[model samples]
Target: MISNLNEPDFIFLLKSGDTSAYQQLITVYKKTVYNTCLNLLQNSEDAEDICQEVFVTVFQSIHQFKGESKLTTWVYRIAVTKSLDYVRMKKRKKRFGFMRSIFSEESNEPIYDRPNFIHPGVLLENKERTEILFRAIDQLPENQKTAFVLNKLEQLSYVEVAEVMEVTVSSVESLLFRAKQNLKKILGDYYKENEK
Candidate 1:
């Protein structure tokens, strides 16, 4: 559907509230957005929810899109922001749960435990290695994690990643460098601990 329309035409139709244009945009971008959310959130359900929310946001905010970046870049930025917001909310909820447990008459143990996150796109042969990599990624600081995921998993170019992250291409490069270094250290520690 989107193949028929050029960027300007699509954006114009989308901004004019054309439902068909919106549907075409969704058909074109749903998988990319969903994958981005899943890699960042590491939870399928949350990723799905965030994916839908990202589209809703794009539809509502189409008028504000300044065309400074490519449409895909803009969409990627929204997906990343929504995913991070979900993670922050989850962290806050966990903290609240811990506080509630401490004051409750019941045992002081926290109730919620995050389930293991296995990305749906991972191949059977690479699952173990990917899981280890994801664990290391989960430990990264937020900016490093975003840079790593966008550059490595999503295969976005440095320029595109910079556009999504709202930083310069060199900053994206530095973030990726730091992310890789941190991952190497983390994975090295994990391997040594397991080897012992």
Candidate 2:
């Protein structure tokens, strides 16, 4: 996307072992891929490793791109898989970031300072809800989780997700429905516990 040229040009350059093209491509996509990883891992070091793996896979497989989807989409697909695998393999999965309470009154929060799961102000707020949702999202099945992340959080279109996922639009739709239902069930249970 940074080059604004097309996926074909990137693929050609990448296939010919043009390291510069690979560098440019990484620059274009690193943050989005890293964020996807961080949200999934909730760990900075692991997220960094997953990001590197995604790019390494990209460099190794440019020839396999087949122009099926945008290079960005392919990269994200690799990243999501890597992140999910990283999470499962790590298996620490406990809730984290509790230190965010120290600076709750501060307007700006530190990135590594640990986000609090609760708030002092309004009993209902976005931060707490998002945290709960992300926690449940972490428990989703692989395909459903991947679909939700790429299509919903990343804002990719269904057609784009379909190409990256190597499935039809209808399948993406079906996965999303199941994903939503599963998430709703999980979060509903969470809220119910809160009511107790």
Candidate 3:
């Protein structure tokens, strides 16, 4: 049903409260959104939760979409923003968790921040290397990390990444360049420290 519909028609159907259209929308984009959230979040449950949140936001905000970008680009933008926001909120909670434990008489166990990252794009045999690469990717500054994830991991074209990131193609290029350089240094230091 959706395959025959053009963008305007699909948007119209979605905005008009067509249930099938909305279902089709989720069917088409769920994996894309889930993978994006997972890569940024590195937690399956959080990714699943945020994937649902992205669709809810899309549903609520479809009217605000002015057709300035492709639907997929807009959806990707929402997913990226939601993922980063989740990460930020988690960081804030972690920062204050110690205080919470102190005041609440909770167990004094050390809070481990890093989850076991398993990128859906990675092969099982390459899990160790993938984890190392992702750890290095996490060390990058936010914009660079986002660009690297969308372009390299998500395989979005530079133009698509630019649209999702709301930046020029040149900016995406610069971010990726700097991201690569930073990743190399980070990974190099990791190996150096572990070479004992």
Candidate number with greatest TM-score: 1
lDDT of 3 at 60: 93
Ranking of all candidate structures by their lDDT, best first: 1, 3, 2
In model 3, which range of ten residues has the least summed lDDT? 103-112
The TM-score between candidate 2 and the true structure equals: 0.74
TM-score of each: 0.94, 0.74, 0.93
Clashes of each: 0, 0, 0
List the RMSD of every prediction in angstroms. Answer: 1.5, 8.9, 1.9
Give the best candidate by lDDT. Answer: 1
> Ten-residue segment with the worst summed lDDT in candidate 1?
107-116
lDDT of 2 by residue, 47-134 (tens): 7888999889889888787875666777877887788777665443322323443545663543443343232222454766767777
Clashing pairs in 1: none
Give me the runs in candidate 2 sitting further than 4 Å from their true place.
2-4, 92-125
Arrange candidates by TM-score, descending: 1, 3, 2
Q: What residue runs in model 1 are displaced by over 4 Å at the alpha carbon? A: 108-110
